[model samples]
Target: MTSISMAGTGSGLVLTASWQDTVPATLTVRAPGQGDGATPERPLVEVLTSRHGRDWAGPRYVATSVGQRLRYRSHELTSSGSWQTLSLTQTDAVTGLDVTSYLSIHDEHLAVRSWTSLYNNASEPVTLHAVSSLMFGDFGAADIDQMYLLRGRSDWLAEGRWSRERLRDAGLPDLTTPGRPFRTRGCIEASSLSSWPTAQELPTAVIGDDSTGTHWSFQIEHNGGWLWQVGEVPDGLYLALFGPTDEHHGWQLELLPGATFESVPVSLAIEGDGTLDAITGFRRASRAPGGGPGLPVVFNDYMNTVMGDPSADVLHPLIDAAADSGAEYFVIDAGWYADNGDWWDAVGEWQPSTRRFPGGIGEVLEHIRRRGMVPGLWLEPEVVGTNSPMALKLPDAAFLQRGGERVTEHGRYHLDFSSVQAVDHLNEVVDRLVNDLGVGYFKFDYNIRAGVGSDSVAASAGHGLLRHNLAYLAWIDSLRQRHPQLMLENCASGGMRQDFATVSRFDLQSTSDQEDLYAYAPIAASAPMLILPEQAANWAYPQPDMTDDAIAFTLCTAILGRLYLSGWLDKLSDDQRLMVAAAVRAHRELRDSIPHCLPFWPTGLPRWTDQWISLGLRDVGGDALYLTVWRRDTEPGQVDLTLPPAPDGMRWDYPSAVFPVESPLRIEGEPSGGTLRIVDVRGSHAARVVKLRSVPVE
Candidate 1:
């Protein structure tokens, strides 16, 4: 940003810079000027094609339009401080536009900036009647839709198979999913939230010259603020939505000068670094609210080399392994019971396959408990297999209908969490595990997409999809409320729907069934790392064509993440088990440090090449610092050390091996710190952990 200025008063763009409680608040713009360009204080500029006026039930109409006209009447609720508007100016360093906008929290003061060559158009404002006309449906919304209602709709629609995009231009193409019902949640590509016109839903008009088009914007109230803006470029495009939760006024603008012009500021939320800083505001911190370390490490059994009837014999190794590694939780994964091509059907039966576990589920829990580890069980509460008991009882009409027929994505069906019966189903399953079976932790899995709704109730709600999503969340809420200390996981076919909402709901998350090998990037980039560490990545004995130590090193690296482990712990060699113990010990050591000091930036983590110097600080006041330099078996380059800030009067050393102070070490740009020389740290070399000696602070 450059050359920012402020203003206070009526009629136009408003920007304000203030100090609140000693916190420096920079310029904030709430409204903008006309025609696609930024002026001082205004954060948005707009462009429009044509506009029309229509009278609805309560308001006059003023809609900037390309194909359809949207009208909304201005309801001025208050005007006391209306004239006390604030204005400011902003010049983007990158764009170099002279941008100006406004800021106001008052009510009943707004105008519609319209751009139109609209041919002798009357100066009438547009009125919106969205509340009067509404559309309700059971099937999920089509991107091509315009209006929606929350009532007068009832029917369970099956899970949808496609998400289609509307194409208006001659050469434009419809984004199609064809016959593909969403497969695994982890695998689905995000569908477009864009369409032809979430733009002209407001008032804006400008006279368009054949040489150029008009630009404009909608001053929308969103997320408890009036300063939200939707910018429309000269090409007639803008996309932003308000949640209807703020009491404020706003307006849109358009410019139609002789030569259609384009020079203005827009309220986008990214810096040139290609960083999505806006995503930070949406992020919720990961440490569970009021949570303590109840279970440090959890081990998974049954998935690795032990998938027969899943018996005490199979668990013997797991128990001894847990005892040796001191893992505090043991989870018995799928296939422990009799599964006959039916995931949901046999699920509710909730009994151990007698053939494998002659001792029974309770007995198995006793074994884990005796070993001082909490026992965990896995369940998919949202799914009801075709052969499941519940599916046999409910009719297809009870579910959602789509295009007129019941929708079914995969063979597994989605449970209508919106129904009371569904709630009972969930509670029943929980009761079986927590109350009867004595399971302390639960892994909740939803391997299917949400389009399934055969429940009679969800059929009529205008906001069926939204409601359903809320209902699922509500059920989780209810469970949490009741079992205040439940450590449950929300796994959706391997890390899908791993958003803030889900993360906040579930105590832990099952990142993926794909536990290792390529788990790092997706979880780091797509999934939020702050929520999940202690993830499930384990060291295993090297399979054929693989070395045992390689698996051991991989497991040690994985232990650094926030995930659980899924492997046959019993099958590990003594050396591998020792490595596991060492990794766990490291995790235990770093558990209590605050986020900023001990936290890691997943994107900046060292690559597998291993010859990179990674840094971590214990505290700002402490002289002690930690850095890891390891060479991957792949790369053979010598690792260079770029020391972070450290105290001058201290000695630094590698793990158990201190490097001697070296002369002629470049210190020009280096922050004051003890210097040392590190030779080649690659080619099957052991990793070195360096700690700086303490220094006194004045």
Candidate 2:
């Protein structure tokens, strides 16, 4: 057997490729310092093909010399700034087809972003049945095994549901195969074949070994149809990440001679610390370059606030109240374009309702500006209602279609940005909103899903959707280019489309549309696991009737991330308003530092009904730690929580509180001991944000 070795210094990973004249090409990866010079048993980048009728290996697999004639070609290494890339090519001896895999790694982030390309060298066209965009080799021991798979699920209101399952319990067992060809492959896949890409499940996963604290995570960076899976093979475990496939989404690509087909992009990370360690690496890789307009405190008038019914009369008071409560952006979300109440079905024309705003929509927008807050408007640019004029006026090619028929879902037709007419329409709308209205921010929302996808001008439905997805990303880039100072918030009926593809470009992401703050605690607490804290815009809508504890609970959820404020601030009592102001003030003080912090959850993943949830953002240098703890209806007035070991001389101080008026809240233990007893937490549904700083040992 021959071995080809490649190293990615920036990402601290080494790749080892092994193959023989009659064996499959296998790839094994290891953290630079891991193992005692031992090669990993399984290969992550498995190559499979339909040419040999070996379709039972469950899609992609390690290219075996016996099944398919694939051999390692050559590799190229390059570096620019902190990013390094290693590209390896494999050639099919029979067909002379070349497949190149590119892995890009960053110096500071422990993640690797990868994509693959297939080039047909033969004179005849080659049809590809499946291709893996990204993969991982096994990183766990086989003998003393206790590993689990972590998956993320999302929905309309309650998003960010993460669950863990033992690999063996999930029908994936570690077997002893010495000289047997084992086809016992069990795969766990999460696919989003719709416009609401993240509506059902998040394209994020984690596999961890409980005995060794080793974890690996991978997230697909596609806006449309995507698939990521964890499969157990006789050698060990393997992960395959890709876009739509022929078997799952009717996707196939025919590459003519010398033509190349590029696969989707995926980011992966492996660490020896915990699942959170892998998450931290992902967050680092996803950090937006050139930075963002500092995380602003926004007050959005939706979700238990205005509920999408906004008017000049209704928003004027809220704008003033938002500005007074220290909100920097007051976003008028949804229902602004309809002259009638049933606006959902008539949403094509992006025009302000004269009936609702007699003085013109610009009047309300100006009112927001006069209140010293940036004006943001809600827009769903990817879909047009079936009853809208655009549905009849625009060309059929401008919308997603299946077999020449328009694809409609939830009373809307998905826009095909690949169509020039669709792109022009979106540009016109955005120009009118930004140039004419002087809107500095936009709450871009998507509310529908185009199932499977369109088949127009493509080999299959999945390929058609993939084309539109690329076009959609280009459109977003164009919008940013036109409006350089624009701050965009991505929402899909509230985070149903929350993936790195959209989240990486937008300034903020609405964590959820959940109105009940108590139920939203888990979502907010777990959001940092998927997105950076600076971009996680959790809602803190404190209604007038909510108890002080409840109001504080909601406010606490927002402060840890971006403070997305709502509710009727003008209707609140004097004390309640002060409390809101305090939360905003606290966020403002910490906003500048949030981008430089890494998140850690002391209580692991939060459950929907978990009595107490803790989220901590620790500075990279161990200078300080900002912690948010929420105590719900559990019996224990005080919860003893174990935290990561703090610096030698760190002391937590009670900065502020929103409830109990006199003696609101305080911490009763030291973090230096690695355990904190949050005492005097008071009533149920209460929360507090504490700041811990390193002091001289005394």
Candidate topping lDDT: 2
Any runs in candidate 2 off by more than 4 Å, and if so which?
1-12, 15-26, 40-68, 140-144, 174-183, 278-282, 290-292, 634-636, 648-666, 680-683
Clashes of each: 94, 4
Q: For every model shown, what is its TM-score relative to the native structure?
A: 0.57, 0.93
Model 1: lDDT equals 0.38
lDDT of each: 0.38, 0.76
Clash number for candidate 1: 94
Clashing pairs in 2: 24-64, 44-136, 46-61, 47-61
lDDT of 2 by residue, 1-698 (tens): 87765565555676666666554456666675567344544433444445543435444444423124556777778878777787877777665578787877766656678888888888987667667787666564632258788888888787888888887776566565778677564566678756677788788888878877767788888888778777676556667787777776777777789898888888888765654565565565655552246888889998797897888888888999999999888898999998867989779878889988999999998988888888888999989999998888899989989989998988888988889999999899989988999888888888887777778877777778888888888888888877888888898888888888878888899988898888888899889777888889999998899988788888888887889999999899998998889888878887888877877877777877778788878776557777788777645477766665556565544333333233344567556666676764445567788776766666
RMSD of 2: 2.8
